[model samples]
Target: MPDPCSAIVHPCLPQNIFPLFAPRPWTLNTLHIIHRRAALARLLNPSLRLHAITYSPFSTTPLHISTPALLVCLAHPCLLGFSPLPAHPITTWHCQSPQSPPSPSRPPCCHACSPAPPPQVPVERWEEAQFTWEPFHQWVMNTSVYRRAVHRNYPMSYPCGVWANHFYKFVFIRNRKAASTTVTDNFDKCHYENSDPRLCIEVVSLNRLKERGVDPAVMWRDYFVFTTSRNPWSRAGSSYDYCSTKWARTDGPCRQPPFSAFSRDPSILGKISNLFHCFDRVGMYHDYYHTEPVAPCITTETGLPAVDYIIRYENLSSDLPEAVRIINQRRDPSLPPLPEPKIYWKKKGQAARSHEEQGVESNTAALVGHGDKYHKCGMQCVRDIYEYFRVDFELFKIPLPEADPAGDR
Candidate 1:
């Protein structure tokens, strides 16, 4: 195949440096280096997709990229003929599907820096325990929370991806982040499958089984419905960095505010006003995604747990396999498992750049990276995020860490 990078990289960077700085099948890790090298080549470009308020009955919508072309001459997947970039580098203990051979104790070379994964587990263990397969699946469906909100008209604000077809028995509703580049790319690179090929059908509702006008419990009995969550502290830092890159207006969501100020403020974490109130708002669509509470957004209006699984982001290497296993089982179980899961990891963040380049508040700069965020923000930030997403920690049973992670390390 022609070098996908040749045309795109030419204007901003030399072709030769690509091989030297990063290896074949390049990634954002390489993009960071390219950004530093091509400061003069920064293309002040933000494609219309950045602000797309897209909705469809079937999932598989176009990717929503915030800053399509930053100063970097590289890293945007769209630039590489829609290739998926590698997931962010985990410092240790990351891996491929449970079936793949275990990585060596350490990578043979520095270039092969991906953290080693645990030994492959038998495929039987990959999923038999997922949400749909849960013994409590019946109870979760019968609970008042699910029943009351099944037909009630909750505000349809969040985005979700879906894959429904004849052969695919389990009605897996890929949540709002479903069609996202990171998850899509991460699919069994083993299978080279991203969104399901039966993509044309589009229906709204991350509340997956509700709109079918049938009992969601029975309707979803076979499908392995599930969603994922991340640590609120890391989640917040990531949100800050993303918004900073897309930051344009001061009054709107993702307007790129100081981290210390943003995390502690209750309004930023808990605000999810109805559409009628925010309909005419300038950044209404963008704001809708940012500040909504963890539980409310994922559950039924009457406060029912909507999904069967909660794949905690921290436990992804172990958890993602459940989703991957079932999806493959539906299609072809014999396919090789995906390579290193493609999660959204950023070694450097845009907020630090904003603070460093634009001289943002000193406090904000100190709290920029994930490790720096919680400690630097202090106890108040931790308590606030915990309270904001209280149901998540409680229902999911995710333990709250001490305010500062540095102490634990």
Candidate 2:
């Protein structure tokens, strides 16, 4: 068979004009070949009118290219030099029946050709294109308090809670008691150790970076910022359990208080409030767990969220991998998939027993040991906690536990 890319010369065209017709890559379809010939004919004789007959690839019927002089080129075989013909008048010819074999006087008919189908787009690519930032922008607009804070030009009073893995261009806003340790550990495993002594020793927040004269705006634009959020009530319960347990071992005033007592204790509450005021307060060494509201921690100096994505703790198992995949794809399309982080936490029974042995009746244990304490807290306590972290529940879309019609107490 002739190469599809080779040029076809027509006897009608002058030698000087024939050399100008360049070969184009095309398949051997009857209609395409006829169209090319028709185009050439038009270029050679601009006044000549032509009619092209097209056929389906499956049909064995032959097509005829008719000119103004009522001349028909049979199966377009003469153009391919398959048979002898007069040069000047473009002598017409005919093809034998499909059942008959080709004779010296006639050539086989050219098959009809259809254009190739377009390439398929990858599903991930489709998803990326369809994804929109509109919903997130709308959510930010709905947050009235956050909007006010941003508009009022108030300086962020608390640490911005951002942690960075410079090597991977990963930034995470740490929410106390929101599986921060798991997130930090996973990043450390995937990339080089964060060597800045301040961050090397502990997770650094965006505000901390600002205090050290490091501009967070650069990281905000340059890195992929992400953070995990837990339901506000559950986060509070976890904070109480983790912090009370830690402080109980030390000489702090909040030492060993059960959840119920701790929630009501004036001294502990005052200290917790003061800790928020003092941005330098470290949760590990202080009585406070650094339970800053989730909104403030994730918000940048400009009042916008510092991170690009928020991975909910409720769906962390699935969401974390997705976030990692998106980040990896953005950084390097050829990078291999990252292994999912293995998360392990103490069982409720073990946690309760450990706390009990430490001489404190775990409030978490008193309130269903394994479940959320939001439902177990009295109405007054719920209201107080809700009022305290109201912005977190509203901004993050963490639903409030349904109140019992008959008061919580």
Candidate 3:
């Protein structure tokens, strides 16, 4: 078949008939109004027998192009018509079958040419379920709040790669200082933009947004959401350190100075730990199963639930594969793959270099403030996320490893 992208332009005749003198195999079926005059001339010519529209009635005029290049005229066909003496002059021609023309009290027009059918689904309900997850996976990875929390807490990490085409909704309610960046990067890598108008859309979040006058499920319907969390004590310190960095900054409350310095005195740290825990005091001890879950610090602000997936900063690499597998089992193949999974790190002393190369200086107060608030808000977010989703930590099958607090026991 000839490529339609390189078709020729032409005009039509008064009778709305197209003429073609050449004898050859032609398959063109439709024409636009602009080229109606030229197309009509071709149909009138005797040598070329225009192919009538398929399933057309007897005496119905047949129209076909002699060459594939002739298809351009179909882009803009002209229609003329006229009524009797008491009415307006009619010069409109039915581009479609006149026998089944559109309403005439209005402008004389015809139905838009039918477009080709979409690709067939491999299976009925099964296919729908699979494609449902692609958008869901995308929603999970797009949360800025989740990504910020992950990058701040984890040492070095990146998102996991997409393993398969199928996926369903994913909800990632990031906890303070978890490996959420890795997950975010992976989501960015998975899919490409699609122009199709039929695909479903969904939204994923760190927490539910309903109670705050936002419905996450409805807002993200036909979509997926996802997020992660961190070990509480470690998360608190990481949040504190990140806020103190003076390089990464955002708007939020409760962020203050001296972020890099962890005061040995718990009293001093407690003073500033309103939303999140006192990192300086809790940084060295605390475990999830050993203690009751802490109340969320920023739950009122974001209206997000705790995390659905409480990914431990200590076990992200091992735990990520299962998440990918679940996604693959649910979505369609057209969605993009997640980015390659790896540990991403700010090189030692590289933050200053980044700012220098960009010809900009990092603001000490701004960066520190953002980092501190991120954790304080993130921890509460994760708790609500997990509770809302009813996702048990056992599904991740992550085993905690022993830690050496002194750098060498």
Candidate 4:
């Protein structure tokens, strides 16, 4: 499609990108010898070969040819794909090849006496260096780990990292805005073969072990465990929007969802105050700071680590199906397979697509640091989110985005 250049190679990845093959250096004259259509293609797409082209007025080499050292795409290189040359490749060719004969190919203007002013601009162009917030924010959010789930019938989300149903022999561990709502709803309907499916409610880590004293190994051993993830940038954005937008509207007092027939179970259902925390800024943050944060729940620092599969939000269309197939195989055949978790979004969540309203997620958990209050999410937002969720990102092998000098306002 787009000449598969930057997409194929990048500055962060050097010669290591093509460890198997290497090419010999070719000079300026080599390019001109190519077929006419090929030259035309270079004229049409410069970055297709050179990321950016430069020229100097005092060079003896004809203005027509540039000897880099460039790429299939062009960017980081000495002159060719080969590295270990000058730290910074010459942006503008300064060679004065006196022995080389000027080709008839040199423009008629190349009257040796007064070569045309090095063409004001390269015939073809490449990168756009402008780094703004909105576009970058949007791009970061739509990625596999950063994608947010929102659509008609926005499933009610309950941010919990530990959830398990002994009856169904499955466990789920994840963070907020990761389709926990869909998993929770499906488990509610999946009960032991003959038991009351209506009362089949999954329990959080606190309830399963602390409150009910269930064995930790029960949830960890031989269970069809799974989890979900969204890009931290988008997850933070979704959390801010859903809690304040047309959905939960956390700006006001809000109540957690009631348990099923087990709603009356004092073991799973804690005190009324615990259930009805104010969703206001103070309330929501208090709830998160006090209750479920990503780390302490999912990290081995707090408990045993176990997960059979992870459903990434970005690949939901395909990932969900694969996870379902595996879970059904391990689960009891009589138990109806869990349905593909549903998704939901809000008016503001869809439009804002920004982090203007939130702060560093791990800050709420406060397990790592006390640095919080990043309300005006900007270029630094990606770095801040990654710092707190670094473990999760690394554990799943998600690539961290390069941070910019922009302040974390």
The TM-scores, one per candidate, come to 0.42, 0.45, 0.28, 0.40
Write model 3 residue lDDT over 210-291, tens digit each, in one string: 3234343232222222344443433444544453333222224334444223322112232344224433433312211112
Global lDDT of model 2: 0.43
Error of 3 at 213 (Å): 18
In Å, residue 226's CA in model 3 sits off its true spot by 3.9
Q: Give stretches of model 1 more than 4 Å off.
A: 1-166, 171-180, 185-218, 249-255, 266-283, 300-304, 330-369, 401-409
Clashes in predicted model 2? 2
Off by over 4 Å in 2: 1-158, 189-218, 248-255, 258-261, 264-285, 301-303, 333-337, 346-376, 399-402, 407-409
- lDDT tens per residue, model 4, 1-409: 3334534644323343242123444322222212111222243334436433332211223334323323445432221232212111111211134443444533332222112111111111100122123532343234323556422111111233455666556666645665556555554434357645432555443333556565554445345556665555455445433443322333333343222211122111112223453333433223222222243344332222334455555444444566666666656666776666454321223323333234423212221121132333344555545554555555444566554456434
Per-residue C-alpha lDDT of model 1 across residues 1-409, encoded as one tens digit per residue: 4343334443222233334323243222223222222221122122201111222111112223333232222443222111111111112222223443434443322222223221111112122222132422332243323553332112223443333332333333443222233344453221234644332223323243344443433333334444555555555666655533433334555244566676655333213222123223335334434443455444443344434444544444444565555455444354444344544422335545556676654324424336566666677777766776566566444566654455532
Model 2: per-residue Cα lDDT over 166-251, one tens digit each: 54455666666655666676644322464433223234444455665645445444556667766665566656655544332333
**Candidate 3 regions with alpha-carbon error over 4 angstroms:** 1-168, 189-215, 218-225, 247-308, 333-340, 345-409
- Each prediction's Cα lDDT score? 0.38, 0.43, 0.31, 0.38
Please report the candidate that would top TM-score against the real structure: 2
| Full candidate order by TM-score, most accurate first | 2, 1, 4, 3
TM-score, prediction 4: 0.40
Error of 1 at 205 (Å): 6.1
* Candidate 2 vs candidate 4, lDDT winner: 2
